[model samples]
Target: MTDKKTALVISAHAADFVWRAGGAIALHQELGYDVTVACLSFGERGESAKLWKQDGMTIERVKEARREEAQAAADALGVRDIRFLDLGDYPLRLDREAQDRVVDIIREVQPKWMMSHSKWDPYNTDHMNTTQFALECRMIAQAWGHNPGQKVLGAPQMYLFEPHQTEQMGWKPDTFLDITPVWEKKKAAIHCMQGQEHLWEFYTNVARNRANHFRRNSGGMAGGRKAEYAEGFESIFPQTVDELA
Candidate 1:
């Protein structure tokens, strides 16, 4: 699909985008796509265990802390436009108001493609809910009756980024992106998530393993390209191609 070279990422929590889709965001930004990240919540309740552990830390303080971390990560990934929905997490209040706000953003950006969490995640309902919410908003953005006059969105492929436990989440990646060129940028973004420092090394290893998959899928060891880092994505829609190579 073609548009004004724009993309959007719907993240359930503040750091979800950085952990799962950071490489894609950095690589696409270098390729000249204006990628915007919409964080549905600060993850203050569930994801910010470290920050919450601090003495005398209130929910508001935890939210602010995670917001700063998210902003820093966004900056590291060269994302100039990052929006925080500030919806309460642990159970996101995805009411009609939230859906309308997201629908507006989808129409405004008119992204060529979108990124979100896996379709199913029993471990974190927030992640899975965000994906459904994204699908709903995407559908609404394309409807002529939803909001009269706005440019309807095209059928952009929605990509689900890798989850923490892929096996349990039913996340099967069909696409592997060689993110070696922007791996440093992604690393920096990952590091910016101080609230989740324990995941830094884990995701770094995930990238390396995916890079190996990239080579294996591209070609055998005999003819594969040597990629040091990569990211995986599961496409939710069938790709429309003129020819199958």
Candidate 2:
């Protein structure tokens, strides 16, 4: 077994990781954590409006384009591994096989932590469905009886990354990560998602706004350190610590 710590991120679509967790991925890499991103689908049908508008665009071609874009983004973020399950999207669904595949990855990575979508997303049903699937897979991964010889998963904290529209999605962030050091890397990763060019600035603004929240939460308005970029997350389970930091 490797000595390096690992992290896993299960994304509903190819570009979702870039938009939501690119900073975290890059920062974790700098901290010597091997971060792996698993994209359930290429988001060809639902998230690729620009490519769809082009002439002679087939589903396979769209998937290919999205794969390239996702790879570029993952490279920019310094991800250790990025894979597409290609299970299909627009209404991303997972069967027993897909769940098993996720469990395999969980056992393989043995991640110290995991990240996924919010529990509920009104704007995109696929996002919530993907989170549910991840949760279920995590559960399955922890069962020793399912696969006799396979390594069982530990109780890793699963963080729910901020959704596109937090207010409507009912996502309340309990953790704020300062990504000021890795903002440029995150921006580069975001730019790689050419299919969703409109989101580049939108997520940048989201990070900047989250920075303000981080400052307020970390200290106070008067004594808070000025953070330039940040990411917000909601933990699905309570964190256990030996001592209060």
Candidate 3:
């Protein structure tokens, strides 16, 4: 296949991409990759506590606010396209229609690699549900018969971004991405999620902790490169390579 550097991120909620993989998106864009982010929901009902606390705040109003915030975050991350599916959240469910929509996006982008939530998340079922939706959509996107005459997707690696609580979610990171150069961009994206201010500090610390892991894995005290910030991912499929490093 010709190298047309492209990537896709399936975020369960509007701010999910920013917190989990903003740095990865920014770094990849710098490396000449066109990154697309698809947020399934605005997270207005479930994730927007601050906005809900407002007097007589409607779900539409909350969703509008979240959309604006997500757009700002996408700009900060240098995303090529940010698609908001606007499916309802809280009890995020993907029926046939929604699943087909996701499949359409996967086939349209035909990304070299994709990113989404971990396999499980008890704290928030939506997170896990979205991952399942991503997997199913990916499978459908690869089938030629799904929609004759349309482009089918190639087998692209799917990386699961770190969940909010790794231990609880059973997410183990096997890949560490050093995103020091784009740390500021990620930070700016993080700030855009003003509705969830508490997560700002939380995700920053997660990046710092991942940097420590990157240092150890890249090379210990022997000569590990210093990374101020990083992101962690768990690959769903084994990578194929001609030679092992």
Candidate 4:
């Protein structure tokens, strides 16, 4: 077992982690956790509209650009590891082989916790599908019978990061994390995604708004902790604790 804590974030697209969980990633890294981000695809076919709009852009070129952007963002966030699965997107193909590959990653990381997209994303099936894939991979990692000799994974809380259009997606955030200390790190990472310039400010505003929720929930005006930025998440599993606060 490693001395340091670890975590894993399974992002559906190259930029998904930047938009949704950059704050969490940076904050965790700052707190001495080895955070690994696995991007299932570069979102080449479906999400690269601006790159595709360019006259001479080929699929390979778009993928290269997106991969660069993701790498830059990961660097900005101080990520310990960033893996690109290169699985084709626009309806991400998570075949049996893909599932086994992800299971291998899950066992390798042995994350204290895991993060992924919401359970429902009608606007983008890729996001929701990624969450389902995460669940399946987590299960496989825990099955000793499947991979005889490898270390069987322990129960790790799987956190679902906030998806776009929260209201429409039926994603209720049960956890609000104050990320004030690392907000700048997250902003820097967000800016690294030059391919999606429009979303830079959008996610910044999301952090600010989530901070408000954090404050209100922490304790209203009477005792709320002062926070400038935060992120929201929904846990897929019940947490076990010795005592309730």
Q: For model 2, state the Cα shift of residue 45 in Å.
A: 0.5
Query: RMSD, each candidate, Å?
Result: 1.3, 1.0, 0.9, 0.8
- TM-score of predicted model 1? 0.98
Clashing pairs in 4: none
Residue 16, model 2: Cα distance from true site in angstroms:
0.3
Of 2 and 3, the candidate ranking higher by lDDT: 3
Cα deviation of 140 in candidate 4 (Å)? 0.6
**TM-score of predicted model 4?**
0.98
> What is the per-residue lDDT of model 4 for residues 88-117, given as tens digits with 9 covering 90 to 100?
998899999999999999999999999999
TM-score of every candidate:
0.98, 0.98, 0.98, 0.98
* Local distance difference test values of all predictions, in order: 0.94, 0.93, 0.94, 0.94
Instruction: Point out the worst 10-residue segment of candidate 2 by lDDT.
Output: 217-226
lDDT of 1 at 158: 99
Model 1 lDDT per residue over 1-245, tens place: 45469999999999999989999999999999999999999999999999888899999999999999999999999999999999999899899999999999999898999999999999999999999999999999999998788888889899999999998988899999999999999999999999999999999999999999999988957898889999999999999889997
